[model samples]
Target: MAVNQMKNRMQALGLLDRSFKAASDDDLGDALERLDDEHREALESFVDEVSVDGVRAGVRTGRIDGGMEAIAAIVTDAALADTIEQLGDHAESPSSEQLREVLPGVVERHRLGVTRIMLAGTVVGEAPASAIIRDLLKNDETLALPPAPEVEIAPLLDTSKRSSDEQAELRAKRKAAKAAKKDAERARRAQSAAARGR
Candidate 1:
């Protein structure tokens, strides 16, 4: 993909946000740690997508040394050897430049390891990519989702003990209501088309 397209995708994924860029390592770590399971899953999935896209782009541009096989070998080798973790300590905050260098490797290792085990039937005794990335970056300062809004749900009817005849009558009424709703919707659409034509 084009550079602009990749950049746009990153922005849409919240990878290029100013808040994330400006956030301190400690702040990032705290934010990441606080994420609920749902948010954590989302973050991991997004990271994997971004990592794969980055690799593909590198391959297309001839920036990366080889095809995916070579990339996988490099990541797997690094993961098995524990070089990625040794690159930096979990407690030490890495600079953005350092993160740029290390994030891809971490993501690729996790993704390929899982794929190898599940699809290729090869065992990969490696830690999850999210864990590695969390350890390395210690950042999630701007990724929190807002609390869900409260909702009140009320039942429209209580039909626990309705007779067969009553049930049939209720079904007929529902069918008629649905048909009426569809007619109203069609009329509204026709009016909208007529207005647009004018």
Candidate 2:
């Protein structure tokens, strides 16, 4: 819906038409599974709470599940509930086994910089990639490390001056090609309408 809205707004402003291709429905579904950092923290907090509560309540096996249920219970307001419902679509209203398969990958993706819920709707398609991210997140505490000093970043890669100029030249060429394509499309439309009248 947001993609369609963006395209429609662009068309209305005469910026572009429906020339952009989006990830397919299945890709979107996969992305829905790849939520961000705040979301992972939210789920983990729920798990921890459930673990604590289960210890107090003497429930033996379901601390994690109970914690999640408890967190769900806390989001009772209208706006939060709406957001929850939208995000729950990631759970995909499917079998437990599928959820189990996807949840670890989602958690792994969260550990990376992919923190926006909006982008999650795009990255979930590459399950293998997500799984690798998850494994790295699981085994590597580097994600848990302190932020590096900005001064240390310059030494990591060789600085190159030609890269930006070459990219700018390529961008200019692409813009020219796109303008010609749009002009041709407009001409075709006008010719087709004229032919219909004749």
Candidate 3:
């Protein structure tokens, strides 16, 4: 039905069914007469494949639960839902540029997730938490994402924001480490001088 609606064609191929007690003589005759030899064989093959006893032969099958629920979750996210709707519009199906503009907002705002970079210009910043994203792009593979946005390539990635106190603390820690190292070096020089005098 989905394919039919998309392609504007009736699914005539779905008319055949073989599950029944038994067909009457008239019904059997009509079934044989309605379909051509090839179609009859095709229908027979389909029926045989679907038959529980026949289907289990020469084939392995496994059951999956929550498959549809997983699909539903992806479709339900605000950004994902919007993208699907945009794609469905057909007339104004967002172009590459639109997808680019849309994705950043979706990631930063709606998705509340950091992306590759936050540009303050000249100085490139943080990278993704996932090494997989970095490696994939590093190898110069065309990502299977929707399209390339008008993005600045120089900004490597976006990191979580740091407040003033956090920055100050980091600087203080670095300065303390440097002073400690310098004092250790001075002590080592004084000990050498004392040993040489002795």
Candidate 4:
């Protein structure tokens, strides 16, 4: 929960590409404006109580755990429920592509808890964000499907050189072979039935 540790967790959760060193007042104000009433209130309280210098001092003295308690309180089960509802409204079966499109907004809204759950790797039991992410990954895996094994149908049917009569002859031969095989199967079944009766 130290600043560095929190940063590491965020990175692991794909929440942060780079560490956040400092925020300008304008940057902070813009971030606050995006938050809901509860989260904004908690963040505002933290901002009110702690200055940049105060945070630096706290980090120096090892007093603050990166305001994790406040973050945890803000990102509650209710907040996660709201996120789930929002995601549901966004898509019925959220594809990875679709999720990626909307994920930034969702993460921006539920940053802390989503990061926490992603780091923990718990889906469904923890936050719905993790479950949503897991489902998207699963959908991606299903959709990938290994390109259908590159079936060599061209080799299987190389009739470009053959004449129409040759092709018709080949088709007739295949039909005859199929009929012969079916007759053999039927004969084998009749023999088996005779043996069973005896």
What TM-scores do the predictions have? 0.26, 0.21, 0.20, 0.29
**Per-prediction backbone clash count:** 4, 3, 4, 0
Pairs that collide in candidate 3 are 116-157, 116-158, 117-157, 126-157
Off by over 4 Å in 1: 1-149, 155-160
RMSD of candidate 2 to the true fold?
21.4
What is residue 188's positional error in candidate 2, in angstroms?
0.5
- Poorest lDDT segment (10 consecutive residues) of candidate 4: 14-23
TM-score of candidate 4 to 2 decimals: 0.29
Give me the overall lDDT of model 3.
0.32
Runs of candidate 4 exceeding 4 Å displacement: 1-27, 34-41, 44-69, 72-86, 89-95, 104-198
Arrange candidates by TM-score, highest first: which order? 4, 1, 2, 3
Predicted structure 4: clash tally:
0
Best by lDDT: 4
When summed lDDT is taken over every stretch of 10 residues in candidate 1, the lowest stretch is 117-126
Candidate 1 clashing pairs, residues 3+ apart or interchain: 28-139, 28-140, 29-138, 29-139
**How far off is residue 14 in model 4, in Å?**
9.6
Please give, for residues 1-198, the per-residue lDDT of candidate 3 as tens digits.
777453321111010011111123333233334445554443333233323332222011110121112211221233454544544653144444444444555444322111211110001111121233333223322322222235666865343577888889988999999999788767755653453354
